[model samples]
Target: MIIELIVCFFATVSFGIIFSVPRNSLLLGGGIGSLAWAIYRLLPEYGVTSIFATSIASITAAMLAHFLARKYRIPATAFTIPGIIPLVPGSKAYYTMLAFVEGDYIGGLELGIVTMLQAGAIAAGIVFALAVFSFGKGIGHRYEGGR
Candidate 1:
């Protein structure tokens, strides 16, 4: 578990560097990725399906990204894009393509569908987080206007 967290942190930081995220934000981005990956790894022990686990992990990352962005006065993407890297289904996508290359149409089709579903779950989680954040901001603004 410790090793996995370390790997997640480095992976996110590397991607952050590749993405040109500001030097000051790299550690926060790495921390977010590690936390999200921890959640993703632990959920399976409790019987959470991959799709649902990915969604929950993504939600975690997105929330952290928003908070970090506001705290640091930077765009959320600085954190989000790298934060979500640890949760990406890269191995599954690779296997999907491998199956196709091996002429296993049925296997490829199944993997492709699963890959798409996982991608959709990630997107749904992000959207859900954004909507909740926006709603909360709206309520805060409404009350602040009376001050």
Candidate 2:
């Protein structure tokens, strides 16, 4: 429980930094939501590993936020901050930046590759989300056509 809370807190803070959240409220709220999702994996049936599960969970939360923002008629970028809180890839990006700062060209190149991988992970998450969402849409359309 404690570990989860810490992860949530860190996730929120990371979200704030990533999305340029103006104050702590967005951070705290996003963190709490992300934490709730992380805790859900504690259930036996979820069969969740931290990497894949959290990626899916994070993207789900982000999509929910996207829907809400659309419903409320707000800028989608608003969701970018809190929505991306759980999966910001901060540590990897930071190390990549540090490598460049330290003048370690080879190390920087390696870190750059890791940074790209992290980006790919994020892109993969978005692609997976889109695929799931599209699959549901396809099923719905087929069912409606049958009617």
> Could you tell me how far off, in angstroms, the CA of residue 45 lies in candidate 1 after the best superposition?
0.7
Q: Indicate the TM-score of model 2.
A: 0.50
Q: Candidate 1 on 1-147: residue-level lDDT in tens? A: 999899889989999999999999999999999998998889989999988888999999999898888889999889888888888888999999999999999999999998998888888877887887777656644555546
RMSD to true structure for each model, in Å: 3.8, 6.9
Off by over 4 Å in 2: 1-33, 36-81, 136-147
The numbered model that scores best in TM-score is 1
Mark the regions of model 1 whose C-alpha exceeds 4 Å error after superposition.
136-147
Candidate 2, 74: how far from true, in Å?
Answer: 9.4
Instruction: List per-prediction Cα lDDT, in the order shown.
Output: 0.89, 0.59
- What lDDT does model 2 reach? 0.59
Q: What 10-residue stretch in candidate 1 is worst by lDDT?
A: 137-146
